[model samples]
Target: MMTTALSPEHSGDETPKVKDYSPTSYITHSNFEFCGYSLKIARTLSASLGVSAYVWEAGIALCRYFEKEKISFAGKKVIELGSGTGIVGILAALLGGNVTITDKPTILEQIKNNVSTNIPPACRHRLKVRPLTWGQDHTNFPTDYDFILGSDIVYSLVSQPSLIETLRHLSNQGATIYLSSEFRTGNGSLPFHEVLLPDYFNCQVVDRLMGKDITVYKMTKISTDPADGL
Candidate 1:
């Protein structure tokens, strides 16, 4: 049934199925179960694509959060940013949200493959994939998306401005942004909380034991309007 510990049996012993043409390739498959639904995800290993080719812990945590919150995606319009391995978006699709899962143009095929493999044909109509480079023109994308989902996307300082801008551009007033990032010890981690976040969205640090390193934040767009009576 449902188990946090992964078993080799869960990874299906079938011969590695070819999904693409990468000169040298390595692949792994895993299963995740939540709310009585199971999803099979395949990951392709690539030196160039780096971590974008695999599912990260933050993604798993977000899935767990969705299950815990009893989030029903039925009829909801959702967008997932940097949807590596497409785990979270697939989970959303299974829950019934009409979801757009996006990443760099180079990464879209892998995500598409994942979506094709895991999501059933009936539920597949609800999922879409697109190339989205944050902080750029997203005029073609929906601005009134009911929910924006991101996981482990706050790792870079260079991208923070565009990230925030993209967030503002995608979210309509009062829409919630759910972002999960691990609390890294060094590098640009602290800036997200200490520096960059204060300048953009109003953030609430979720106080649950998501291990010591991982923290999930619920963010809402901060008003830019001058005070009526503040």
Candidate 2:
């Protein structure tokens, strides 16, 4: 429960930019404890698979937010996009949600390993890892999710469009969406705002206590058309 303001000079990015590492071999560990539940998870700390394998500050901020708000995930269907290291999704499953943590195909096994390693046997059935390439159609993925979670996903402008589209496709009507990102970055939040505007999602900045200047956005899909039934 520390409120460290993030600066560009010291963003606390744990994963060093390595030229290359075998995705199957280079492993790193991340641990979390929330609401009387504790977990230790691991990931392949290499960017070789087009995925990050370390815990980001934005993600830690999210875990803190959930802890502070006492957000309950019991019986809720949730999907976490860009679930790097799968910490947040694992936490949700621990809170009683049927959660799916997703990333690119290359890093799925690592994510699965993290889930298998962290989730308890009783809750293991609720946590799953799926391969998801942002900006692509997710018709094959689960829909009607009650909540959608993403952390530090807005850094890349090129991927924002596809990310927005995928969110639109997967989100159920009136679903609550939470997105967290670092403050004072070059990307800021322009791309997310511009894309989400046409989609009619009511977005707000919820002030939460977190390390650095990580901004957590609370979004809810507004049903503008009555014909769009659940």
Candidate 3:
């Protein structure tokens, strides 16, 4: 949300100069209720911060899915990828999951702040915010996660391969992965699940929000047989 503030110079030539603006000046907060708790989330309107700074509809859809389905993450090792605003992961922690909320290095600070705003001091130990850049940082995390969550993360075809690789790296055979995305034309999100994912994981549509163009997919790693094609 970087806006250019132009101030006219007093010189003979009427020229405008740029005024510096603080990034925090563009931040706004929103409150959402989940698990009987009111969570306040801060979002930066700066486009430079990228789409991760705003809360997408898909994220809220996933949150509702969690409540409607009564999916239990209690005592589970959970991680959320591309956790913009950390809403989904925060809700999971409130529901009793030991959760890790992650995004790229530049966005980690925002997620950390959101985690602090929502999670109470005593229960804050259940949540952690860390930097993770898809394929590059996948190795730093363990592969034994019980649940992996993502929302609105599959908009880029260019990043699909790395995203899939990271998902594979973080999940074991027993792990379940939930991803919610808005279906946009030429976004590669639907194809990521229908085409790209079947090779490494078994995926199915677990929920869809009518009229919202958002879908929630539940996936699990497919155990391979070395001799299957031999």
Alpha-carbon RMSD of each model: 3.6, 4.6, 9.4
Q: Write the per-residue lDDT of candidate 3 for residues 197-227, one digit (tens) a residue.
A: 9999989999998877789999999987677
Tens digits of lDDT, candidate 1, 79-138: 999997888888888898999999988888888988998888988889999999996756
TM-score computed on alpha carbons, candidate 1:
0.86
TM-score of each: 0.86, 0.82, 0.86
Better of 2 and 3 by TM-score: 3
How high is the CA lDDT of each candidate model? 0.77, 0.73, 0.81
Candidate 2 structure quality by residue, lDDT tens digits, 1-230: 32332332222323333333563546544345666766665656444754366667788788778888899999999999988778789888988999989988877777787788778898888888888897664777866899999988887767777877788888877688998887545774655664654466878878544346668888887786868765
RMSD of 1: 3.6
Q: Comparing candidate 1 with candidate 2, which one achieves the higher TM-score?
A: 1
Error of 3 at 72 (Å): 2.0
Q: Which ten residues in a row have the lowest lDDT in candidate 3?
A: 3-12
**Model 1 pairs whose backbones collide:** none
Q: Candidate 3: TM-score?
A: 0.86
Show model 1 residue runs off by greater than 4 Å.
Answer: 1-23, 207-210, 226-230
Summed backbone clashes in each candidate are 0, 5, 3
lDDT of 3 at 121: 92
Q: Tell me which residue pairs clash in candidate 3.
A: 1-45, 1-46, 1-47
